[model samples]
Target chain A: MLDLAILGLLFEQEMHGYEIRRRLRDELGLFANISFGSLYPALSRLERSGAVAVTESGGTSSAPLLSTGSLGGERAGLRARRSGATLGTKRSRKVYRITGQGRALFEQLLEGEEPAGADDARSFGLRLAFARHLAPSARLALLERRRAQLTRRLATDLVRASGDRLDVYTRSLVEHSTESTEHDIAWLDRLIDAERQKQAASRTDGARSADSTDPSDPHSGDAMTSSSPTGAS
Target chain B: MLDLAILGLLFEQEMHGYEIRRRLRDELGLFANISFGSLYPALSRLERSGAVAVTESGGTSSAPLLSTGSLGGERAGLRARRSGATLGTKRSRKVYRITGQGRALFEQLLEGEEPAGADDARSFGLRLAFARHLAPSARLALLERRRAQLTRRLATDLVRASGDRLDVYTRSLVEHSTESTEHDIAWLDRLIDAERQKQAASRTDGARSADSTDPSDPHSGDAMTSSSPTGAS
Candidate 1:
């Protein structure tokens, strides 16, 4: 999940790990802090796998002189210069950019299913956060896929609530949960309806403007705003 | 999280691992499948910690005769006879019941904070699911803590949206996500309000009816319905 978010951010701009964490927390609004422990390891793995490229360039080096005065710091800097100190001690800022391979991997991972019992709110939110990168059809598919998943979950919740064995509080909790799922489903339906309407509108606009300009592109008149529904997460 | 759910269920009834999974899925309506790999290890750990006791009892032996008369069946039968098999072919059934210590552990685990970047929809949902077991004050605290977490998240989300760096769709996604969090916080507020009203009502009732049944019990006049707002998840 973090990998998908990382690639999505890097696809926009090359960033160091700190920028990635900041963007993930601030922009994407997912993964809150995205601990450096997990972030660096994932970056290393992606770098090792050739999905992202890390270059030791283009970072402010104002404080490096004072930090590198110590003999031990000098030795560590030498080691870093040799093997590339990716962990960031004395400001060898590694700017990471997603490769063509990384873009492919990101798409693959975004299209993939999270492990069962782990995919609902966070995974869906992250995917939808990057939904603009998806093709129109793919975006529709994503919405529909989430709708189906939530529908199945609603079924299970309804079944669970039918048991009548819960106390007043637990039952209240279950009923409220059921209502929330219902609201989510209703929200998704509105999104799906909007997507379908937008797709249809774009198709009509495409047919009419086929002789003028390419209508299949995302910038057409009826693509985003014609019948935009509540496409919130 | 799973530990809290498990102990909550076991507080009601002694159950084996499979039963625990079923209850989690069907009753609590969380932890859909709870993989056996993790589940068994958790059970073993709890048993080792004396939080739960493994009693060898209470499982139907009817299914065992189905696949037994074939190769390796004789050895299985001998093993079952030796261990006095309670459920399956290869092993004795382990029914886990919460010890007194387990109840303490359950409360501790439920009250503990999940690491930042992790405590989220699932954590909040689990806590709400077990809210009935909590004291009224603790329950209100949980709801307020969640509200604060979400409120902070909403601030970050608004900041993220203001950058104007996102595409139309991504902006819509972020805006929608913000709205969703707002909805969640509002729901939590309702729950907290109801809880406060109930607590206040209980204090009043206790002052009035000094010799009656405990006014602050979970089943009192102001318990769920009196001031229950739209407290869905």
Candidate 2:
């Protein structure tokens, strides 16, 4: 899960270890307490596997430290320059950039089957966060897989509740759990409906374009807009 | 987390290892994939700590194997007896029962501050599952603590989404995550309200009972009903 989160972030931009940790907490809202102890080891493992390349910068270079446009990066760079450590023999900051191999690995992991014994909620959240990079079908599959998992959970909860000799609090907990799962399923249904409609509309546009001779039609522009990286309406 | 779950089960009734595993999966709906490899070690740890006591049974003993009244236990017992293993040198099944110290441990763990870096959702769910054992004030605190955690998460998610360069899918994921947190908080609010009402009603009953001279008034029965172990109104 940590690997997936790290690769997903690096897929967007090169980042040093500190920046990656910050984004994991602030931007991703998962792995909020990931420590440098685990983070450094994961980074080292990724480096050893050739999934990422590390480049040292910020020793004497006046260039900006981070590739990200966030002000936090600029401030960190300024602080480093002001400290006069740039003139010392200290090792430079190592920025990690995802290699082509890492990109392939990310895609593979994103599209892969979730392993057993994994934390299901975190696994799903991490994949959903990076679903934009997935093919449309793959994205739909991800949503459906999550829906199925929750559905099974609800079924089990109902079965357990039905014959339960459970105390009041446990009964309430089970009922609430069932309701939450149902709510999630309803939400996924909406997303699935939207995806199908978008896919159908795009297919109709493709057919119309093939039937017409116009090279610059408005419908083609609409198709491009709908299929843009954001995949938002 | 595993220890809490194990003790909670044993607090209800004594059970052998296999029965405990079954309940942990089928009843709790959490730790569904817990293997014997981990389960046995946890049981051993608990036994070593004097939290649980184990007794060997099923050797030439016709007594029901499990304290739980589930039909599954009957079948397992019948199968063991039918296979003639009950008469063999195969070690008798070990039935684990929670000790007084174990019950204390369970309560302490349930009411304790959640450790950092733990799986937050699982920790909350486990605590809520056993919340019937908590004092009313502790139960209210648990609900409020969970509410505060979700509120903070939602705030962070909204801030991240506001000035975000996130792709469409990630943006949608964040939005959905925010909505889910809101849904959870709303659920907690209802629980908190119910808890407060129950407390108030009991207090009113107490005041009335104190004012009355009759030791066996109808209101006393009402009070008893409300304070029953089931705690369901």
Candidate 3:
């Protein structure tokens, strides 16, 4: 989960660890609280896999800078070396940029199916937060999958509420849970409908334009937006 | 959480491990899937700590049974040996009853303050499921604590939503989450109001009767029923 979020953020801009954490907390607000304990290792793993490149970043910049090391042993002197020999503090800062390989990995992780259980809610929410990166079809699949999961939960909740002689509190909890799941399914339905409508509109535009090619394919297209449903806040 | 659920179930009736798991899933629906791996360890820990007593219940019987040992021993004359010499499976199955110490432990665990975190929802749900066992004041306190927790969450979520330039999908997720929190707070308010009314009603009843005392104090009084608020389905 942290890996997906980290990559998504880095995909936006090269960032040091502190800046990444700050953006995660203050900007995206996807993760309410993230510990450094889990963040550094994810970055290091991404680096080790050649999916990300690390630069010294001049101790101040959080952007990617080419390493001023001996590229050909002689090119080191061809251009004045950047002042990024040993940038960033030992631990709290080291600019990380997503490599071409990292973008591929990020897309794969974003589209992957999450395993079912307690982490399902967080996983789906995280995926939705990055839904703009997904193909419209994949985005629709995400919403549908969550709607199905919630619908199944509602069935079990209803069965428990009906069959069991629950006390007032437990019964109320189950009933409320069922209502919430229903609300989620309704919201997903609206999103699905909007996705279809957007697809149709783009397809018509693609057909009408003679000179312009439709970039509606997964890799080229912009994200589709959905209006809030009648079942919303 | 497992410990509290186990003790709460046993507080109602002495039960075998299998029966306990079934009830947890089917009856209370507390743990959607309570694995035996966790349940057995909890039962063993409770027994070791003198919080529970295990008896050799024949695999088929789910009722309380006397402990029997050494069928051929001379002490059979003092008391006839029960047929529990070779009862239950080797380890996975045993009848566990809450001991006097166990009951005390259960009460303490049920009434204890749960710290706010990832497990807060499950912990609060488990506590509310067993609210019948709590004193009225504690029940009210539980609802209020949850209400305060939700209120805090709502504030942070609102701030995040307001400050962040969220994508449509993520913005929707946050808005829906905020709405759910508000709904939960409304439910808690209803519960709190009902708890106060129950206490007030019992106080009136106590005042009405001069000769016969009203047994409407915390433990003796029945669980209060809260009507679902206008904020609910």
Candidate number achieving the greatest DockQ relative to the actual structure: 1
List the candidate 2 regions with Cα displacement exceeding 4 Å: A57-92, A116-118, A207-233, B58-87, B90-92, B116-118, B207-233
Q: Lowest lDDT 10-mer window, candidate 3 chain B?
A: B224-233
Better lDDT candidate (2, 3): 2
lDDT per residue (tens digit) for residues B30-68 in model 2: 676678998988998998898999876656554544553
lDDT of 1 by residue, B1-233 (tens): 67777787787677789878877778777666678988889898888999998765322455543432223454455566665323344444566899998977886776676444565777777877777666566677888998898898888678667986665556766777787788788888888888888778868887453212233444322233333244332
In candidate 2 the C-alpha lDDT for residue B231 amounts to 32
Which candidate leads in lDDT? 2
Clash count, predicted structure 3: 0
Writing each residue's lDDT as its tens digit, candidate 1 over A44-81 gives 88987889987765334433333312446667766765
Score chain B of each candidate by TM-score: 0.73, 0.74, 0.75
Native contacts conserved, per model? 0.54, 0.54, 0.38
Give the TM-scores of the predictions, in the order they appear.
0.75, 0.75, 0.73
For residues A112-198, write the lDDT of model 2, one tens digit per residue. 877545478778888877766666666677888888888887877787779656656667767777777888889889888877776
TM-score order of candidates, top first: 2, 1, 3
Per-residue lDDT for B1-233 in model 3, tens only?
Answer: 78899998888777888888887877665577788899899999998999998866232356544445212233443245345432334333466889988877787787788768656888998998888777666777898999999898788767767954566777887787787788788878988888888778767778442211123323432322232223121
